[model samples]
Target: MIQGDTYYFAVHLSKYYPFSKRVDRNYYKVEISNKSEPSYKFYTIKELSENNKYIEAVSIPPKKEGYFLEREEKHRNEY
Candidate 1:
């Protein structure tokens, strides 16, 4: 939660679209900083091939904080 902290998150498409076999999970790298007005920003790093046909999905819960908390809560609820 502190500024200048970077967090990594994975978006699993399987949970949202169980029936869809084409959707692949996406990974997002986020950094916490005060450079912007929101105090945070999200960056999409190219992990997979550019030609890969995958739908990027992020299931972060609604919150006043950044996606970091939402990602943490998602894992907590799963177990």
Candidate 2:
């Protein structure tokens, strides 16, 4: 994102494992750096509340390059 912009991630887990399968949906505690970024992101979060909801968890400043893909998707849907 930009210098001071904030980004949030929503983690969703589908039904996996036989008896233990469950849906753990929650707002990610922090922004997720893409797979290629230097920091290790929470790809597989172990626990999340089922009814977690967030409004536009990620924010980008005027010149943020990190959420390029996300920006493109948002633009396409807007029009």
TM-score per candidate: 0.19, 0.18
- Residue pairs clashing in model 1 are none
lDDT (C-alpha) at residue 51 in model 2? 14
Candidate 2: which pairs clash?
none
Query: Over the stretch 1-79, how does candidate 1's per-residue lDDT look in tens digits?
Result: 4435544343333243321223345423333223322223322344221213322333444455668687788888686
- Candidate 1 segments whose C-alpha is farther than 4 A from its true place: 1-6, 15-44, 55-79
In terms of lDDT, the poorest run of 10 residues in model 2 is: 48-57
- Candidate 2, residue 23: the lDDT equals 35
Cα lDDT computed for each candidate against the true fold: 0.37, 0.35
Model 2 C-alpha lDDT versus the unseen true structure = 0.35
Top model by lDDT, which number?
Answer: 1
Write model 2 residue lDDT over 1-79, tens digit each, in one string: 3234433353343423221223345322332332322133322222221213222222324355658768787798676
